[model samples]
Target chain A: MARLSSENLETAYEIIARYPVKKSALIPLLHLAQEQDGWVTDVAMAHIAELVEVTPAEVIGTCTFYEMFKRKPVGKYVVNICTNISCQLLGGEELLHHAEQKLAIKAGATTADGLFTIEDVECIAACTEAPCLQVNYRYFHKITHGEFDSLIDDLKAGTRDEIPAHGTLAKVRQHIPAARRAGAVAPTDRAEPVWLIRNRQEGAS
Target chain B: MTMNDVPKIITSRFDQGDAHTLDGYRRTHGYEGLAAALEKTPQQVADEVKAASLLGRGGAGFPAGIKWTLAPANVWPRYLVVNGDESEPGTYKDRMLLERDPHQLIEGVLIACYAVGCGQAFLYIRGEMAHAQERMAAALNEAYAAGFVGKNILGTDFSVDVVLHWGAGAYIVGEETALIESLEGNRGMPRLKPPFFPAAKGLYMQPTIVNNVETLSNLPWIIRNGVDEWNKLGAETSKGTRVFAVSGHVNNPGVFEVEFGVTTFRDIIFDPKFAGGIRGGKALKAFIPGGASAPWFYEEHLDLPLEKVAIDRAGSMLGSGAIVVMDEDTDMVKAALRLVRFFARESCGKCTPCREGTTWMEKIMQRILDGHGRPEDVALLMDTADNISVDFMWPPRMTTICPLGQSATTPIASAVMRFKDEFERYVGGPIELNVTVKGAAFIGPPTRKKEGSGV
Candidate 1:
């Protein structure tokens, strides 16, 4: 077990003080220690217990309670796939399998190269696009087996760069002049067409 | 929003009778829970609830009786806040209860108010959920017209009012304090904990009891069915039936009430009576045992029971009982990127780590996905995550202000930890410019401004 650094202890106390119930800040404090050390160790839990004036059992209990906190060391990149109702109906299961096979690691296991850790997540709320996944924090929607393979291949090949610029509503309006007009298909409605078309296209294939 | 409303639990009582209308509610068993409670001692009501062993169904499996008992008794004009803002991604069980069974929620609210000595109850719904708002409002009006909601209910001196408030469509508002803030007309940012426990100081500074839609809905049933009977349905630690919204990779995806520990992932996912497994014999890739923020589970964890304790042991959570399944043919990097995008967008921007961390993480993810990543950037991404996580520990305690801030890094941190190779694969690659914009922007004020302006 790694020693809980003084810095992490101080940080934990600071968080506990901010909340009405020190226990409430437990999740965030664990996040900090894990962030600093790359994982939550037993030593860290003991320090958090001291900071929050709770028992080590309590700290560990809360840590083990939530899914977000990492008790063990993880890989460098986490692939979170959405396999909820919407994403499932949209082929989330198949996409997940493809990812696991391509990465050569089952979901929840780090790759042999220590480069990737794949996880399955619940609904991302981008149901309209369906079958979505998040590499790090960016969303890739309306994915297909081919698209999924290509995304991994591109990541592997290091051929894709530059974050997709956030396209403002204005940019969307510029593309479809009718969008700016009143009663022009609502932006949400307009957005659905692409995904719907993609779904149909994939279905046809 | 339609006439084909199905009466599940609460609505069954209101819909079958004229109780949906104010006059009808008066004639029927409207406010009966409150009336029953008012006749008995508050302690007795609390005891009954405790005996019921009812647990909160809004993600955390907190005991309802324990929550009510925690409220400081000295505080007057206490509040009973109902969290109707069902924003936990893939968890729509509450919406069904709120829209179709509003009266049940109302009765449960009144009972909870009476038990906790609360004077008012507020139902905070997401701003986007206009239809739910309408149905709830109409239900409240009916209760009021029937003399259940307004002053001097049933000729007893006790009076309580149920108010409906709309949120600005923020997922963070689902947090109790944040919901209180939004109800109070502030930006829907979550407050720091320790001194902010809603039971002690909530709403406009008074003791409060915040329960989720499903939790409150369960109250009337608990009262109807003794705690022992309710506890008989599930595990000893987690008693009673829970409503799970099963979605993703299932033949039939909908909400089903199953006893705690009585169901398994395979039973739900592969059972023809339930989800019936992934479509078209597609192989299962991963599964999110809870809401979006919960850690992912692979096929190895399939037989794991879909219960709080079981999932927790598996390094995941049974969050809101929203089981999202992913199949083969999915990209791990892209999936992680999508979740990161959600955290970035949904972040209330109150805490530095969450606000900047989520945005930066999204950017890094995008770069990797777009094929513009550098090998060293992988470590940089980890460093950035480390920095944000440090910030995540501040403010609300030296971390971000609320669960939103802390949870914002969940997908990114987990992804980077679990899928580093996939991220490394994207390093040193030319950017893939195959970005396609699918839908019109969601109907909301522009979150990002034109270039040159301070975003």
Candidate 2:
């Protein structure tokens, strides 16, 4: 197990302090541990248990409970494909097959080169873009078999930029076109009927 | 396309632009409810809420008024928690509200705090939703700056402060008690029920009211619209509109709102205006009425009214209203395997049943999918799921832990029950999976690519 530096430990403590209850820091602490060591280990779990004043069993229970936490070492990039109802109906199975065939490994298995691991995730909450995959926590939406293959090729060629660490909001904005962001009117904007819109204009008082 | 596209109830006020921003919200009578709420006594506010009969929109259909009344009276520093950790697989309604109309949620939080004598409130959001957290925090800052939140709210003696706390993104955090624990900086595992209900001993051991994001978001409207008016929109028992996240094989796969009893699955899915049924004339196989955790239904159940009671009566839940449809080509075994795999992976492992039970279920499903199933495995899977305990007792039941164990069994149980033939077919031979390409022939060998090898 990799030893977490004092800085990471302090950051964990700081995150716990921010919450009203120390236990709520379990997920954040695990994240911190992973951020520092790339994966959680038994030694780190023990240390987290001691720091949080919980039993080692409790820490282990938490680490194993959530799917996001890695019990074993993972590849540099994780591809989580959504095969839930929405995605499945939209040809998610084909996409998954394509992904497995392209990577030459089944879902939940890492590639031989240690570059990627593919996982079949449940709904990723991005059902709008059916057949989506989260490549290393960054979402790739509206994926097709051909598009996925090309994406892999781009990644292999180093043309696709490395996903930035702290630019998720920017990434989301980038995903949504500028026109949609600026001109996409919400439901509230047209609350009244069209007659009302015309009446208000005609009867400006 | 416009308000015309949205049903009247859940989105009566949706078309009002900038409803998230203070000025935009106020122009559409947003905080007017707060003023109305403050004018009356707390008991009166509670009574009005009780009269409205609003149920929690975050999966559990518990009444909001009942939750408020359950809180201990005269407790100092009582807490109001907004369960914004929308981790349910099919659910994304809370995320939409938080990201698009945060102030509405904040206003609802304020009203809820006022009704329950809560001075401090926390919005526990899912951590993976960095954008939502940022949007909510920005809204909180705007509300605080405008004196809508924090010390002497709206120039009244009654004060409330709202803070945004992010969950590490676990589905269990959506459970109220677990949500309380997560808010307190602990692991987001759920505690035993009965003694640990959030109302009695919650959030640093103070009386707390943990309401779903949509539930809280409804308070301001309920107060402003009056209970009588609110009751007019929906059925007698389940009053008000619900935001349904319609995804799956539908044409218009987005969030839609409808009155409680008015919208049926047929109207929501087949209507040209709404979801527009399965895309490209694909035959519907089944649909998950709620999130992935909820039990699934076959095509025959399409006519089942998409209501809380009706769906529950059909042995499924209206959980998070994340309608996930499946078409004819969908593989039930693989789908069930994928769903169970998520629960297994996310099982917080607090109790043996959930941790081990989920793992066992996943393994069995995987075995079946991999064409390595024995006949006994089917009965064994059912027995294992049935024997799995739901109670998480002190010293750690090792056998039980909240409903995580029970919830994990749902997809498997439902899939086996509904699609028994599919599972049986895999046992006889090497399953020759079929793939149909719309405009192309069978592709060549699958492409092999390594991650981080530059595309």
- Per residue, candidate 1 scores C-alpha lDDT tens digits across A12-129 of 5544433334444555566556656666789878877776678888777556533445688766555678765467557787899999888878899988776567887655444535
| TM-score of every model versus the real structure | 0.63, 0.77
| Residue B148's lDDT in candidate 2 | 76
- Per-candidate DockQ values are 0.04, 0.14
Residue A115 miss distance in model 1 (angstroms): 48
- Predicted complex 1: DockQ: 0.04
lDDT of 1 at B37: 71
lDDT of 2 by residue, B1-455 (tens): 23244335434445666666778877877788888987876667889998888888988789999988887654555678888888777676887787777888888888887777775677787766656666687776667777777666777666655656656557777788888766655567788876888888787776778898888888888888788878876666678888888787777787888777557777787887778888889888777778876766665556666666666655567878888887787788888877888788778778877788889988988898898997667766766666563221111123464766766776766666556678888776323222221110011111321210111
Cα RMSD of all models vs. native, in order, equals 21.9, 12.9
lDDT, candidate 2, A1-205, per-residue tens? 8555798776666555444556666766776677666678888888888777888788887676556678887766677888765677677878998999999999989888776788887666777678788775666888989999887777666676754322122122111111111121111232322222343465566
| C-alpha lDDT of residue B441 in model 2 | 8
Give lDDT for model 2: 0.70
Q: Give the per-residue Cα lDDT of candidate 1 at B316.
A: 54
